[model samples]
Target: MQQQRLPLALFLSLFGFACAGTARADAGSARLPDWRVSGFGTIGVAHAGEREADYTSSVMKANGTGATRSWSTDVDSRLGVQLDTTLARRWSAVLQVVSEQGLDNSYRPRIVWANVKYQATPELALRAGRIALPVFLIADYRKVGYAYPWLRPPVEGYNVMPVTSSDGVDATWRWSAGPVRNASQVFYGHSAVPLVDSLHLYARHGVGASNTSDWGALSVRVNVLRADITSNIGQDLFDAFDAFGPAGQALTARYAMDHKRMTLVNVGASYDPGTWFVMAEANRAISHSFLGATRSGYVSAGWRWNTLTPYVTWARVQAVGATLDPGLPTAALPPALAPMATALNAGLNSLLMRIPQQTSFAAGLRWDLRTNMALKVQVDRVTPHDGSTGTFINPTPRFVSERTSHVASVALDFVY
Candidate 1:
């Protein structure tokens, strides 16, 4: 069993008592105490049509359950709070906190960001404390779903890398050239997570940099980040799949996964002309390899008009050797269980050999039902790059058998 630890006591102790007393005494300090507090929420349910594939966690499947379900409807439903404070001349601070079903329904108030800033000059600023790496232009506003025209950011692309956040210090630089506005950031930090064996997650800590440019109708951002991920369990992901089946193995060798540091490169661009908006991004991640290092990427485009925007997305998830254990029974099983065993074995083999490449075709629509509130509907048809996505298409005892998951939802989001 994996045990998750929350380092909240430290944060709680400092959340209020540590506000710099001197900042309150400055000339315009009274204005600083005006707390602009806001609440944002999303109440949604998704239906996952996995056609009976067992799903242990929604985080891995589509929506929240991913695609390992026979039938599921809700993805990730969450809520959050934010505080924006202007602490005297050219200085400001922010804190955004959230609670969500993470790492197996372990709901905890994760401090998304807690930082202070001082604008030394209009174009330069210094900041310290925990901060989220603004890998994407929308990364900072991810919690504000109303700002986006999608029922959900395309999971096939947006979630390839966990939202990279860390305990560290960083700086920002903003400037403009002719019709282009530019901003750049550099940061360094240390990050870590808890739990291992049977269940675990690798949290890495390192330094990174990002830059963005806006030129009239064109906007672009490029980010480069490197971190020494701890790996799912400090074991070769492939070997772990084989030896770490649910039954648990004898537990052979275990070693930390390091790059020295894993590096990720991403580039994004968007074009808008009032009535239409088109956007896309491409990313590549490379790290050490026992089976051999791996690379993955995706491309997507969307269009918007008024409050109703419809999109067509096609994406492929490629893994050279990322397959884990298929949870299959050994061969030579009784006749009654042979069919089940065979299915498991095949799924396990493909996963182990990296034989499965997944392709998806999806269409979605988002409607701004009201100010700060919206409703969305989408449908996706998924096909395995090889074989039934590594498992037998079985009828889920608890849910109806469906080849595709149809999802629709209404949500209210506000920032005040």
Candidate 2:
């Protein structure tokens, strides 16, 4: 794996070096007509009513509100700066860096986008380097808090796939059909992201396509993606299973996260007139490994009263495949190994319980403080179902799976 990553690491290093050199070269010049710089940030805090588990925005975060802390800024605080430059009439480039709370519990600046684009024609464009994956309707702007009406996108649907970008190439074509305008994109790439517990998620041989259409105030999108994913999140547990001979091997083969294939399908739509807006999205994840299969969706609507927008959202995530598996009949084992067998079986079942099955209802109000700044306050009632802990992390012994948690959040978003 290290060898495979060498090329990408070298490419990124060279790209950064070139960009830095360009900046230094342009410093002596008075005006840079081809260069543009912009930035965005969010200052936020959240508190979760449940004390036994932490409520995190995504698995990439190490800790969040509730048990970890009374109020946490890691759930939403972030800063991003982007530089765009036109290299030529047909060539352009963009570099964006973001600093946010990461799985290692640090606010490290990472490259969110570093892509060069070639304008093939009036309606076609090609790009190479790290590009954002268009997995959902608002995926391209999900990190820009000021661009959206909610404090954050619904976690139930957005957190299913934590990956944000990939290293590869993509092509986009835009055309107008009658009264509707359409944009279609096709991409191929691979991604690797670090997670908590020293685990890493890798998606190889990823391919995807998406299309979006806009007509008046209405917009709709559909996307399909597939990849071979691997993770070592539960290495210790799987290693123990490997010790139990063929039965244990079979169990590991069925549940281990070893180069498993996963497919994702997403459909979304939105309508925004001047005074009001409504948006909804649905996602389906198919996998045969321990990740299982899931159906998730969310619906949101808001009324714009002057500069204040009040919005309500309902979201749900359910496991559609088997959440638990009967592994190795402990009773059939030898008397001396019965205890160990039973323990292993219990452990396997416990791991399976991590699958998310939850429902959330949220209401928020966004106050547009200025044309470039906004303040938001939101409250969510989250309930775990079917003994799943939902998206909460760091569960303690006192954690109850079916318990409901109420979270309150406030955020200030700005762009400049």
lDDT of 2: 0.88
TM-score of 2: 0.93
The regions of model 1 sitting more than 4 angstroms off are: 1-21, 24-32, 54-74, 194-202, 231-260, 289-303, 320-356, 387-416
Best candidate, TM-score-wise?
2
Q: Over the stretch 1-416, how does candidate 1's per-residue lDDT look in tens digits?
A: 11112324433334344355435556464444556888777665555545344321122322243335433333546678888776556666777787665553455666777777777799998776667877765677766677766656655455455554676678889998888999999988766543323544444567789889988888898988887765443244335434435432311221225334567777878777656677777666655432223333445556777777786666555555444544445454467766755554454443344322345566777777777777766665655443323212222344332244434333444444
What stretches of model 2 exceed 4 Å from their correct place? 1-33, 196-198
Error of 1 at 289 (Å): 5.1
lDDT of every predicted structure (CA atoms): 0.56, 0.88
At residue 49, give the lDDT of candidate 2. Answer: 100
**Model 1 vs. true fold: TM:** 0.74
